[model samples]
Target: MSGNTRGITREKALQLTMRKCEWCGTAIVYKNAQAVYCSSRCRVYAHRARNNPFAALRNEKRWVLWDTNKRPIMPSGAPASSTDPSTWSMGHVVNGHLNIGFVLGDGFACIDLDHCLVGGRPNEAASEFLKSYPKHYIEISPSGDGLHIWGTADEGPGTRRIENGLSVERYTTGRYITVTGRVFQPGNLLPL
Candidate 1:
């Protein structure tokens, strides 16, 4: 038999080490060892499933579209009320809205950290807080210098705390927070 130093032909060795595509179960031949999908279509589908980090939020009914000014508006550009369900739209609808927001209530709260980034990284206080509270869906704000930490908390009035190093606002009701879908830490919304 034609073989190399290891006594096994290269073709036989490749057959022994062959792997299957993760998405379609196809036998992957030309891809690298780290390849997961056999083709770009499979890769796209896998990414859509695994990285839809906001799937849980979309399943909820507290969604609304926002305008350029961050004000909640209906899909037809009419003003919307966070307290009014009739004005709200399903979270899954795209509807040509420039931005998306979620009404804060029903035990859900968002900790909005304003200007919490320094030199393209989270500031010290934000980093410290994230280390302590790492089990929630955290995303960078639209401005790219802040973070929105979403979690569950007791229903309460909105409160703002400003310090020398950190500025934070917590809201449990009567407000809508813009959704950027820019994830910093991927996790489920946990209790705060």
Candidate 2:
């Protein structure tokens, strides 16, 4: 065998004596009895691979209300009554409201919610609606049993108008609303 071939065989023999690479799962061959990696290139590739998944998820165009940590503050109990002014408080509004649609920076729109719970339980009617419509909608207060059905304004066929005067504007402290049997202003709701 050539000198390089002989060296490789010797390295392979030495590698059989030790553990393999943790990242690539390749055996580490030692020609000089002290090799750490099967190849130097493999070491560099493994290092870069660690951060690639996170980067890819961020770059994708999707509606994600929660941060990368996946921590969402959910509310408990029934929804506020329409006539109650305290229901619109910040604390109640923040935790009680569900993210129905998102507006992308590029002006493109995407729907996020696939399955949502309504009226303190998964809404069979809404679930059926999704099965038939295949559209995205979010339920903020499943216990109260209301769904915030929405899609990107740019992508939606048209605007949604609720007879109760429901809107998609950001919650303000002055707005009167009710949540969980208690009446409060917008200040009572939790921030997203």
- Model 1, 100-179: lDDT tens digits are 88998866679999999877698888887778666677888888899999876668889999754789898989999988
Note the Cα lDDT for every prediction shown.
0.77, 0.32
Q: For candidate 1, give the lDDT of residue 13.
A: 80
- Candidate 2 clashes: the total is 29
Q: What is the lDDT of residue 175 in candidate 1?
A: 93
C-alpha lDDT of candidate 1 relative to the true structure: 0.77
The candidate that wins on TM-score is 1
For every model shown, the clashing-pair count is 0, 29
* Candidate 2 segments whose C-alpha is farther than 4 A from its true place: 1-57, 60-102, 105-116, 133-158, 161-192
Candidate 2 lDDT over 1-192, as tens digits, reads: 436655566556655667676444567644445555566654543443343211222332222232223322223333432223332223323433443112232212222222344434545544554343232323343224343332222222322332223322322221211112211111111111
Candidate 1: regions farther than 4 A off: 1-53
Positional deviation of residue 117's Cα in model 1 after best superposition, in angstroms: 1.1
